[model samples]
Target: MLTVLPAINWLSVLVAFVLYFGLGAFWYLFLFPKPYRISLGRSANEPQSGNPLYIVGPAVCSLIITLTSAVLLYALNVTSYGAATLFAAVVGGGYLVTNTVNIAINPNIPRPFLYGLITGSYHFVGLLLISLLLVAMR
Candidate 1:
């Protein structure tokens, strides 16, 4: 019974994807531009890249994450609000946060922990919202 296709809610997935991507935009651009730059070991005065990949890449990733979370929520039959929150927390903290920290542990990321803290927090919150929305819409 691994088929989650029939249980999927496309509308919720769309809304959640928007919320997830929108949150990323707000998080990086408005909320923590300076701190994020510092976490990347870059100065405020440094020239930012205008590459489309920067935008497109994360959008794709967010969509994937959203869709995946939606499938899991439906497949696992997480219907209650409290259960959704707990599931989100577990998935967020366990996979997203841990993976963010792991990705940051590289030579390019001078302040790995700081970067992890910033990005991981975004994913954590995004997952929470996504799961909640999915459950609510279901």
Candidate 2:
């Protein structure tokens, strides 16, 4: 654990976290604004509650995901681009995406599949980029 901690490029992890969080901002706010709302059975122009949790919660979650990915990359000694990509696919798809889809498969989410696809895709892409960055920086 001590060896792995020093080996991690902290700056790269910060950058990856920023990229992942920023991508989510762009994704939900700009790219799929309407679709995301529709998935919740809300109108496109419906005003969202100005709740701080809406912003802070996701940021915290993204940070956690980024840190976890960084630790995993270091612990597993992923040293190449191919390995990074494979790591992304397996972790992103197997865990993140699958859990996201499972969460979406609930009565609350009106368009369960669409919501899962959009949200899961975001996590997958973020993981892909973050994993690659971690490997490159390592």
Candidate 3:
């Protein structure tokens, strides 16, 4: 499957990765800071500054996820803007949403459905942005 690497747009993948990374930043920082913290059973004001996992884990994971998504998009031959967005919606909704909801249903979850709603929505948005950037860059 990866033998198709030459056909893939590495530049588009990079752009999509960067865009998704930026969206994650704003999504966690400004959009759902308090609610997300509460969902994790943390006080919003609790210090996360010294935690490398808090900072680095997500960033690394985001890059890996974006890379995978880009590979999927390339394999799917997603070309046009409309097709890209549609593919993102279908894949993100079908797979990512289910995964997110499962996390929310975990036995250790603090608040039912709350984190799922936020996290799942963030993933959908990230997928959408990644799609847009990839198609536009093409």
Candidate 4:
């Protein structure tokens, strides 16, 4: 297994968190908002209250996901600098695409296939990036 220096790994983790959140904010606020509104058939002027649970729940989940991926990458003996860059590109980029598609489709009909496609694609790309980062650190 690759042993990553604590300081470097922590820094990388911080970068990852910031990047993910920033991308998410961008996607929601600019990229997907139109599709989301259209999908829900909601007017742009409607008052939408932010739900604490919704915000907190996703934040907690994202933290767990990042930590779990980091641990697994370490355990799997994959830690390198290149891996970090790759992970950021692939995983982060994948989420960007997935969100775009989800907003574009905004399907009214039950579509398990579509849902699975988006979810699976996002997870796969994210894990790939995470794994690459772990491996590179080693």
lDDT of each: 0.93, 0.92, 0.81, 0.53
Put down candidate 3 lDDT per residue, 1-85, tens digits, no spaces. Answer: 6765787778888877778878888998899988887777779776546767876787787788777777777778778888988
Which pairs clash inside model 1?
Answer: none
TM per candidate: 0.96, 0.95, 0.89, 0.53
Estimate candidate 3's RMSD in Å: 1.6
Give the alpha carbon lDDT tens digit for every residue of 25-125 in model 4. Answer: 55446655554444455665564458787567656655666666676555544456566556555655566445545554645624434443444445455
Q: Per-residue lDDT tens digits of candidate 1, residues 1-138? A: 449888788999999999999999999988988888999999956666899999999999999999899888988899999999999899999999999999999999999999999999999999999999999999
In model 3, residue pairs whose N, Cα or C atoms come closer than 3 Å (at least 3 residues apart or on different chains), thus clashing, are none
**Candidate 4 overall Cα lDDT vs. reference?**
0.53
By TM-score, how accurate is candidate 4?
0.53
Q: Which of the two candidates, 1 or 2, achieves a greater lDDT against the reference?
A: 1
Q: What lDDT does model 1 reach?
A: 0.93
RMSD, one per candidate, in order: 1.1, 1.2, 1.6, 6.2
**Candidate 2 local accuracy as lDDT?**
0.92
Count of clashes in candidate 4: 13
Q: In model 4, which runs have C-alpha deviations exceeding 4 angstroms?
A: 1-8, 37-48, 80-138
Instruction: Please report the candidate that would top lDDT against the real structure.
Output: 1
Question: Runs in model 1 with CA error above 4 Å?
Answer: none
